[model samples]
Target: MTAPLPSLRARVTPPDAVSPAPTHGHPPLIEVDRLSLYYGAARALHDISFAVPERLVTAFIGPSGCGKSTLLRCFNRMNDLIDNVRLEGTVRIGGEDIYARDIDVIELRKRVGMVFQRSNPFPKTIFDNIAYALRLQGLRRKSEIADIVEQSLHQAALWEEVKDRLHASALGLSGGQQQRLCIARAIAIKPDILLMDEPASALDPLATAKIEDLILDLKQQFTIVIVTHNMQQAARISDATAFFYLGELIEHDATSKIFTNPARKQTEDYVTGRFG
Candidate 1:
């Protein structure tokens, strides 16, 4: 018989340990230098700056519409899809300017994956949902596609739950399982950075806890940037936390410091439940 699979809890890295950077002394995996965004006449983000180290979880926290989601989309240029949406400054991945004239948007998105607030699985079989990207890339061998599908599901911490029902429609899964399927689909492309916008906000307590555990495990292999409303979740899961308000980044520091004793009053007040 095959060896028993490891438990999801066992795959998770301890909260206190830091995953190594993808490369040594090089620039961060993602760099947002003085970045700003606008929708027609209104500005959404202003002079936002931060560097996301590889294999680490960086959480963005703020009140609703503080531009946390907007900034998260900027990493992969999702804003480009909106008409008259203007972007200023630079967002670099692996030291390459993503906004440069020569960049390919399709390939860029493949390199920087995103998971939205709500889980969106395709109207297809669970296996196809995970294999879609690879199929689009012209992968024809059935065995190869199957291997990657299983591997991606394993990486997203969903293998055991779905392995027996790969032929079932993706919509048949629970909310939490659907979200994990989305994560599996995103990682199937082997992205270098994963952007999550309130990934756990819609789930129940138990489901949310499972996602938090999955995020911690995922960071061992992928750089994660999440926008969350839960201060305790941020403190528990993120290695670094950035606090934003009124279109400005108030503070960016280690998660512990930001939670216990922030350098800025706004951060302190926000974390201490005084104000959002």
Candidate 2:
């Protein structure tokens, strides 16, 4: 029989190996250099910066309204959708400035997909939900679409559970299954980075466990960035963790160190439940 999938712990690299700068290894896949964001007169993120390695899970963790989610949206420029928003500095993916005047927002979003806290499946069949994104990208052949739909579902770890009822309505699935369907749809277009904002916050314990498992398997293929308020969950899945507070990035390092021996008193307080 085929070997079972490895657990999350099996995939973690030691803390010493995780570094902010290039240390005889591949350069970061995503780089944020002194980035700051403002909503009108209110600054949502101060001068913040960090680098994210490819094919690993990097999590942003902090208390509510701490700008973790705001920074996550900056990766794909999701904040541009909001009115009166201004930004400074640079966010580069693969060394290209994402905010450059020549960049195409539509194509950028295609390369970097997002899954929100609440699962949102189209009001269509499970097969169609996955196929819809492919069609939007101009893949019209039924055979090609079918193949991609299957591949995406398998990547999201939902193919076997729904293969027999591909035509069934996605709305009929449980909250957890709907979230997985949304994940499958996001990957159907073959994006390089996956941004998850509190992806498991809406699910029960069992479903949350499944989502965490899927994240572990997915990091082998795609660069994953997530924003979560759950400190324990961050310790469990992330290779590196960044602690944000009051719009600033307070500390960023290997997940193990951030949890056990964070550099800042503020970070320690937040993680240890002394204060949010």
Which candidate achieves the best lDDT against the true structure? 2
Q: What would the per-residue lDDT of candidate 2 be over residues 1-276, giving only the tens digit for each residue?
A: 111323323333222222363212545889888888999999999877778888878899988998999999998999998999999989999989999999999899999999999999999999999999998898999999999999999988899899999999999999999999999999899899999999999999899888899999998788889999889889999888888888877777778888897766677788899898
Separate clash counts for every candidate: 0, 0
Clashing pairs in 1: none
Candidate 1's C-alpha runs over 4 A off are 1-27
Model 1, span 1-276: residue lDDT tens: 111323323333222212222233434688777787899989888777677877889999999989999999998888888899998888888989999999999989988999999999999999999889888767899999999999999987889998999999999999999999999999898888999999999899899999999999998889999999999899999988888887767677778877886766667778999887
Q: Which ten residues in a row have the lowest lDDT in candidate 2?
A: 1-10
Q: What lDDT does model 2 reach?
A: 0.86
lDDT of 2 at 49: 71
